[model samples]
Target: MSPTLEFSFRIAITVDAPTIVSSDPARGKRQLIPILGGEVSGALEGHVLPGGVDSQFIQPDGLCRLSARYALATKDGTVYIENNGIRRLPSAFTANLFGDDMGFFKHVPVEDIYFKATPTFEVDDPRLHWLTESVFICDAKRTPDTVNLDMYRVL
Candidate 1:
């Protein structure tokens, strides 16, 4: 029997409060937290779009989706939040690693926040490979809890 290979990574996040020009209460709350011991989904060549862009597609693949639920707290204990979510990235950024938009963030923000995740395998498929080691900044307008952002791996 082949021994299972588990891929792991360490994630570091920095959250800052919104700038003076922008009026968001969550701005300037710079924080960095590290999440150790995470798992990944099967990796593939991703998918191509109408505009001729390739992405690590996870829509149809059952093995490439990750749902993480974890907790975070400030050293002072003044703030605490539950960090959890499922996310992925386009293959272009991971493939090239350089461009105007790396597809890492769906949106930018300013907020009082700390980010981390506890990764687990939701599906079982040997052919699938997971790749989620970057931090994302999704837009507050599109999601709930504008001040709190959820982070995840590429899977």
Candidate 2:
């Protein structure tokens, strides 16, 4: 039988401007989006501090990939979460891509794109350390200024 996953909660993260680092024709487009600041609610509560970043890649095939590293500080202590994910855009959305106009990514219909990720937590506080021992998944969403993730733990 398949494993059952428990629903945790949603974490809405706000991001700052993305600094495009590379745009090589052979390699995928790379950009580093800064973590401006945000909050965590639902099962776990805390604030997402500044200084973390999401290093993203957009492949030539139009696939969107994400590599994000950030920290969360709860009332008790802190933990670091590393998230990796992939996004698939609807065919209609992909057909409209052009040069220098990636802005559409921020406004795509929520139902038109699919995003998913696996996240690992590095925890030091014993109370919250159980996070490091579980398997987690996130349904990630992106807006012009934020990233919304609904996380779940696999049991």
Worst 10 residues of 1 by lDDT: 47-56
Candidate with maximal TM-score: 2
Candidate 1 segments exceeding 4 Å error: 1-34, 37-64, 78-81, 91-155
Pick by lDDT: which candidate is best? 2
Which lDDT tens digits does candidate 2 get at residues 1-155?
79887888677898876788777545667788889779888778988988999888878666878899999888768878899998888766654332444567766887678899999998878888778888999988877667898899998
- The C-alpha TM-scores of every prediction are 0.20, 0.88
lDDT, each prediction: 0.25, 0.81
How displaced is residue 15 in candidate 2, in Å? 0.6
In Å, residue 153's CA in model 2 sits off its true spot by 0.4
Q: Could you tell me how far off, in angstroms, the CA of residue 151 lies in candidate 1 after the best superposition?
A: 9.2
Clashes of 2: 0
